[model samples]
Structure formats: C-alpha cells, structure tokens
Target: AENNRRKKLLRSAQKSIMLWDPDGPARKPPRESAELLVSADAMFGLSDSFQRCTSPDFLLHTIGGTTRGAIERAYDWLIPIISRLPDTISRLPPSTSCFLLLRAYGADGERRAQLKELSTPLLHHVQDSLRGTLGEAES
Candidate 1:
C-alpha cells in the first residue's frame, strides 16, 4: 500500500512537471529543475524517498564522484528536498522530527538558523520535547 502511494506521488510530480515544463529535465539548467521538483513536491506532497535522497551522505558517498552527470543529477534532487525539509520534518512523528532537527542543528549553524526561520509550530513542539528529554537523559 505504501509502495503504491509512493509510485503515485512520483507519477503526479512527473506529470505536473511535464505540463509545466516539457523540456525541463533535459534542457533547462539544474537549478530550474530543482525549482520544478520543489513545486512538484509541494503540489503533490513530499516523498519520503526523495527527502532521503537529499541527505549529505546520499549526495556525497552515493551520488558524488561518479561522473559529472551523476553529480548533476544529485544536485537536481538535492536543492528542492532541502528547501522543503522543514515541511517534511514537521510531518514526521515527534521523535524522528526532533532527531533530524537536532542533528542538523549540531552540524551547521546556517542549517540551524534555517530550521529556526522555516520551522512550523509542530516542529517547535518537537524541539521542546527534545529539550525536555535531553535534560531527563542527562540525570
């Protein structure tokens, strides 16, 4: 059931992009493709797989250093997933959301700032829970 839903989401995103920009994937610049993907994800709903694809490990170890084409493809997937991250995280269960945000906050100040800037109210709740748990765990 979940797999079927994911396939449908991908198809919806693809169909929308084809209508919006027929040659976008092949001809347009990568940033433009990223924008299309972001719009598509927003319109159709975010894909968990697509969000995972944007992770630095996936980009660096899996997609990076293979070829120009591969890196370009990675960049195409990366930007928009990152752009929609706050929304994505907000939709996750509290524990998972808190883990991701805490990881991001520890890694880069800029990312922490972005999370602060773009976070939904749900995300704030998760953060608060994470803070509460942190103190409990330390005791």
Candidate 2:
C-alpha cells in the first residue's frame, strides 16, 4: 500500500512537471504554470516524492538546457515552500540541498542570504547525524 501510494505520487509529479512547461506551444501561460506548481495538492511531499521517483543525477535535469525564464518561474513558486520545510524534511543529501540552494538563490538574491542564515543550524544537525552514524558503524 505504501509503495502503491508512492508510485501514484511519482506519476502525478511527472505529469505536473510535463504540464509545467512554460515554452511549449501547447503549454499554459507561465503564471498558470507557476500557480499549478505551488498548489498544495500538486506540491504535497514534493521533495521526498521527487527523490524517490528519480535518481539525483536526473533530478532537475530538464531545467538545465531550458530557458532561464522557465527555471526562474518554477523557482519563484517553489522557494517559499522550500524555505518553510522543517529540519527533518530539509535534511536533504548535501548535493540535493546544494542544487536547491543554487536554484533558489539564483532566482532571488535576497533569499540567498536568508536561506544561508537559516541553513546553518540545519547543516550542523546533519553533520552531527552523520557523525553518529559513522561512530556506530565504527563501533
């Protein structure tokens, strides 16, 4: 049941990502795409869903060659939610966190500073967690 639910969420996220294209001829307008991306149902468990559904190497892969406008629009909608993630949720792998920060900060300079400030404690927590895990392994 849990696996089925996760698969459903993955499919839904993929559909949402496809529909979010801002430049495709049949795509909705940028504003609408942004709105859809931020909708609660659309965004539920977004980070975990994405991480489970796609390998990290391919996460955000589509945005790489896309126009900055499309990437920026997505970031605009995503940043607020990303900022509010609890420490438990925000405890993403280092690479994932870096990718998120790069996109979030690239979209809004002001947020870069705020996110940096907020991440300090989260980073320390993650480091401590890693240390504990390593210590247990060693013991």
Candidate 3:
C-alpha cells in the first residue's frame, strides 16, 4: 500500500511538471501564465514531499531513473516564467531547494554536476531572500 501511494504521488508530480500549453493562434492571458507559475511552485513542493517520503534508491527506481531528467525539464519550463516574475524564484519554499540539492548529492558524478549547476543560483537566491526577510523582521 505504501509503495502504491508513493508511485501515485510520483506520477502526479510528473504530470504536474509536464503541464504546458502549446503555442496557439490565441496566446494565453497573463493570468493563465501566472497560474502556471503557481502550479509549478506547488509541484516543486510536491516533489519535495516525494523526496522526503522515500529513500533515494527507491525514488530512482520508482521514477525509472528519470527523476533527474524530469527535474531538469521542469527547471527549463520554469525559467521563462521566473524571468517574468523575478521575485518568484526567491520565494520558492526551502524544501524545494533542499530536495534539489539532496537529489544532486545522491546522483552519479555527471548528473550531480549538472544538477548542482542548475541549482546553485536557485539556492543562492533562496538564501538571499531568506536573509532579506529576516533582516526586515528585525527592523
């Protein structure tokens, strides 16, 4: 039952990350784009939950060793959205950043290096944002 639950959660995460509207004659409104960004953030949070609920080996197996690729693809999808909303990247919850780092750590050297390259800026952004927030609270 637990395994089934984990599998279901992983599938759901994959589906969320894969959600994208293809370009059409009519462009989506700004609000729809904003909603996509919000959904991506929620998906990241959900991915973090998956990281916490299962062992690294189990997760890799469950996702058919495609977790890294999925994460990278999600990052690609998110960057444009983030560029439009500069503050959005920094506002990502710590769990999302932590999970990315943790997965990087567990990966083989090539994937580890790739994930680190992708996550470094994000980690720094989150750190800076937290510091700024705390500083404001003290003022």
Candidate 4:
C-alpha cells in the first residue's frame, strides 16, 4: 500500500513536469542519424557514436595522428564555443555549433580514414568481450 501510494505520487509529479514544457510531446532520438541534439534544458548538446565506437578509450585513440591534428585545429576552432547555448536563447552567438558543422563537413574524409584504421582493432576487442560476456551470461 505504501509503495503503491508512492508510485502514484511519482506518476503525478512526472505528469505535472511534462505539462510545464511547451514542446508538445517529447520525442525519442532516431539513434542513427546525425541530428543536432539540442534541448532547452541541456547545458551541452549530446554526442554521437561514430561507427558504433562509443567507448571513451576507443574514441580518444580513434579521433588519430594527422586527423587528430585536423580535429585539434577544428576543436580549437570549433565544438566548445557553440555546444553550450540553450536552443531558445535566440540569435547568432559565437558557439562551437558552426565550427563543428564546418568541421563535420570535412570530418568524413579524415574521420573515415581514422575509423578504418580503428575498426579492425575495435571489432576484435568487441567480439572478444561480447563472447566472454555472452558466455558468462548464458552460464
């Protein structure tokens, strides 16, 4: 009975919270598209997982020598400046969004090459880890 009442209150609270927002209903992510993940509440936009390489170690190492140089230039030039503004603040502000967009336009060339290099190593480790985990889970 106590748990039931608490659950009811939680549900009501959630409903009330949702009502305060003007953006109709919240939509889920497409999960595979390259859309900007902006939110009025977000301090920073969400990140993307390139080629399913979401792991930090994988990203840090994968993001490359010459490509890293390019990205470093872009990162310095872009990424952080625009990632912070709330979508509704309104106006052309100096944000990393444009830099990132510009970088993204070129990101494919270097990123693809970097990804190609990282892919084999990443797949090998993922396959190995999944095998062990799946085996353990099955047991």
Candidate 5:
C-alpha cells in the first residue's frame, strides 16, 4: 500500500522533471527550479526508502513487502539507475564513482544473503509444521 503510493509519486515527479527545460537560453543562474526540486525530492525519497527498508525493525518485521523475492526485483530495477546516479550527478569521474556503487552492491548482496539465511529457514519450518499438523488432522 505505502510502496504503491511512493512508486506513483516517484513516477509523477520524474515526469515533471522531464517537463522542465534548464538549458533554454533565456534561463538565468537560479535555473530550472521544477527540475531541481524534482531531483532533490527524488534523492530524498531514495534515501528514505533505503533507510526504511534496511533498518533493524524492518529486517525483523519484513515490512514494505520486501520479501527476498521482492528485494531481488528491486535490485534488478535499481542497479542500473543506482550505477548511473553518481555519473548523472557529475561530482566525480565515472571510474571513481564505479567503486562506490560496486562497494554498495557488494555490501547489499552480503546483507541480503544474511537475511535469506534466516527468512528461508523460518519459512520452511512454518510450512513443514503446517503439513505435519494437517497430517495429524486426518488421522
């Protein structure tokens, strides 16, 4: 529910960002307020989403519908965008920026593995327990 809302907001904001034209010659130094706002909004949103999903409470509760499968889906969706974000920002060379993205990717993969180690076993246990319970129900 919350995720669906957030995703919609992100798409609308990005669309608005596209509508702004900063490079038009008539523009002054203040520059492209709509696009800048959208970008800032987007960066804030990504930061917030990442923080929320990775927090200890989120790990325990498995909130945000971020199952192992959903997280894998998010990784597939975000990897290219995350890789491009630093390059898109232009504060550093792409080569140096690559290291930051790679490091993040490595750490994230490790954490996901740790989560799966716990989540998968617990899920299997629950399923097995259910099967056993149902078996006895018939006898």
Candidate 6:
C-alpha cells in the first residue's frame, strides 16, 4: 500500500508541476502571492522525494514536469529548488533523465549553462545506450 500511495503522490506532484498555467485566469505571478507561496512549499516538499524515487521513469517524468514549469515561468514556485538540480543530477545514474535534462539545457543558453555542463555524463550514457538501436544519428 505504501508503494501505491507513493505513486499517487508522485502523479499528483507531476500534474501540479506540469499543469500550472502562468497565463491562467488568476495564476499570474507576484500579484497571486498566496497561491504561489503554497505552490513553492509543495514544490520544495516534493523535491525531497523526487531524489528518493528508484524508478527511472518517475524521475524522468518529475524532472520533465519541473523543467516544463520553469520554462513556462513558474519561477515564483520553482526558483528555490532550481539551484539544487545540479546536485540531484550528479547523484542519479545516467538514463532517461538525460533526455529531459537535455531539453531543459537547450531552452536558455545563458541561464542553463550548468545543466548543459552537468548533462555531459548522461549524454554519453544515453549515446551508448542507444548506439545501435537507431544508428549514429544523435537525434
């Protein structure tokens, strides 16, 4: 039952991160201080568990959601934890996490240089993992 509960929580976290529309009716930042405050708390709380998840799929999904949120200007809530990504990425073994991290790194050249540098090992791992499956094309 604990596993089921964790999965549910993970799903909820992903949904929250991915579905936060900055342009929504009342979701505008700075002015919407209350909601943004609550969201920031939740994001920090979930980030602790994000590091503990054993499944690569869940890690990829959570990181992807967070990256999407950041790109979409969910900075009010995600800014605090964004700095910790390099540490998180350092601990995780190279896997599907590379795919999403690469996407995040590509979004802003100046802002995400750390992600670009940190993704080096993951990029190599992904390259080796997919070497023969689709030929040498570095998608």
RMSD of each: 13.4, 11.6, 16.8, 19.6, 17.0, 11.4
What lDDT is obtained when candidate 3 is compared to the true structure?
0.50
- Residues 1-139 of candidate 6 have per-residue lDDT tens digits of 9778655655554445333555774333332443454456576875466554656644444345434443344332332343455444433333334544565566576446544554565565556645644324434
Instruction: Look at candidate 5 and tell me the lDDT of residue 114.
Output: 41
Compute each candidate's TM-score over C-alphas: 0.28, 0.34, 0.31, 0.22, 0.20, 0.34
TM-score of candidate 6 to 2 decimals: 0.34
Backbone clash pairs for candidate 3 read none
Lowest-scoring 10 consecutive residues by lDDT in candidate 2?
87-96
Clashing residue pairs in all predictions, respectively, total: 0, 0, 0, 4, 0, 0
Q: Model 1, 86: alpha-carbon shift in Å?
A: 4.1
Task: Please identify model 1 stretches exceeding 4 Å from their true place.
Answer: 1-82, 119-122, 125-139
Model 2 per-residue lDDT tens digits across residues 1-139: 9778756655555555544446655443354454455465455956556533445523345334335454455454344544554443233443344445454445457777656655664455445545776435433
Candidate achieving higher lDDT, 3 or 6? 3
For residue 38, what is the lDDT in candidate 4?
27
Model 4 / residue 16 / CA error / Å:
37
lDDT of 4: 0.36
C-alpha lDDT of residue 92 in model 4: 18
Candidate 4 lDDT over 1-139, as tens digits, reads 9778655644544443322235576544342211222222233423333222334433234333225355465453123322332221122112222223344446576554443443343344434444665425533
Q: Which candidate do you rate higher for TM-score, 3 or 6?
A: 6
Per-model lDDT: 0.50, 0.49, 0.50, 0.36, 0.40, 0.48
Worst 10 residues of 3 by lDDT: 57-66
- Superposed by TM-score, candidate 4 places the C-alpha of residue 101 at a distance from the truth, in angstroms, of 22
